[model samples]
Target: MKIVSLRVNGAGQAFIARPGTTLLLALREQLGLTGAKRGCAQGACGSCTVLLDGQPVVSCLVPAVTVDGAEIATIEGLADGQVLSDVQQAFLDGFATQCGFCTPGMIMSAEALLDRNPDPTRDEVNEAISGNVCRCTGYEPIVSAVLDAAARRRSRAGEGAKL
Candidate 1:
């Protein structure tokens, strides 16, 4: 077993994992963070998406050891003290989720897109979440949620609100 240290959801975390262990497995089985789903374990599905250093990544495709020293953000870390992030709230308000299995990954992907481009166009939003396959929401609500979240973020920033 190898000991890896990384920042998870704004907190420092360490875990002992085998060399071939995927990040998804490490997060779920080792760290007890089940937010990253175990969808297509081959990375074809975006259900296991997470943010690695603020970039959306397929956790199932990434080896746990490869994330050493990187900052990993899971859906569990998006909220603070019972307050949901703007993107999460938008998803809820827009009814973007259906079965909820894809919500975590979709949210993380949307968060990464917004982090880089707070005001993304519809095409960009679609491109950002393209990897995530939501069989339930049919992609319309998800797109709307991202756009709504971006607008909300801009409004909050205009008011000098801190994220």
Candidate 2:
């Protein structure tokens, strides 16, 4: 096993990674961060999505060793104590989650989207989360949630609120 270090959720983390260990596996098994699920292991499903260096990536397809010293952000890091991020709050308020299997990935994708584009059109939001798939609560709710989240973020920015 090789030791891999990464900055996750703004904290430094280190864990042993066996050969061929994917970032998803290391996050779930090694670091005990199970927010990113292993839905398809094949990277077809965005269930294992996370931010690597501020860009969204399918964690299941990235080898742990290849990303040593990278900055990673998972769903677990989206909340500030009990306060949820704009995307997360929008998802909850908009009733965008059902079964919740795809919530984390969807939220991560939305987070990346808003980070780059504070105000996004519906088409842009759809394109941002195109990689993620939600079996329940069709795309409408998810899309609406993303749009709502964008508004929330903009409002917060106007108020000088911190995310």
Candidate 3:
């Protein structure tokens, strides 16, 4: 077993996992953060997406030991005191999810995109979330939600700058 220390959802956490354990397994099994689902463990599916140091990464492809001392963010961390982030709210408002199984990964990907590019074009949005596959809501609503979230974030930032 390998001891790993990571900051998850803004909380410091330490756990022991098998040497070859993936970050996804470590989070779900060791830390009890099951937000990142295990889909195609081969990294073909983005169901295991998470934010590593504010960047989107397929947790299934990351080794737990490699993530030592890294800050990770999952779907559970996207809300603030029960208030959803703009991206999450946009997903709900846009009805971007059907089964909701892929919602967390999609949201994580979109959040990463918006973080890097506050104002992204449709093509950019597509490129950012291309890794995530949603068989339920189609891709239109998901793209729409990301675009809406970006706009909302820009609007909020603008308002903050005015203050």
The numbered model that scores best in TM-score is 3
lDDT of 3 at 84: 93
- What candidate 2 gets wrong by more than 4 Å, as runs, is 161-163
| Residue-wise C-alpha lDDT for candidate 1, range 30-122, written one tens digit per residue | 999999998889988899999999899999999888888999999999888789899999998999989999999999999999999989999
What are the per-residue Cα lDDT tens digits for candidate 3 across 103-143? Answer: 89999999999999999999999999999988877799999
Q: Rate the local accuracy (lDDT) of all candidates.
A: 0.93, 0.93, 0.93
- Which tens-of-lDDT digit does each residue in 1-163 have in candidate 2? 7888889999999988899999999999988999999999998889999999999999999999988899999999989999999899999999999999999999999999999999999999989988898888888999999999999888978888653
The pairs that clash in candidate 2 are none
Q: What TM-score does model 2 achieve against the real structure? A: 0.96
Provide the global lDDT of candidate 2 against the true structure.
0.93
| Rank order (by lDDT, best first) | 1, 2, 3
Residue 60, model 1: lDDT of 97
Q: What TM-score does prediction 3 earn? A: 0.98
| C-alpha-based local distance difference test score of model 3 | 0.93
Candidate 1, residue 51: lDDT: 94
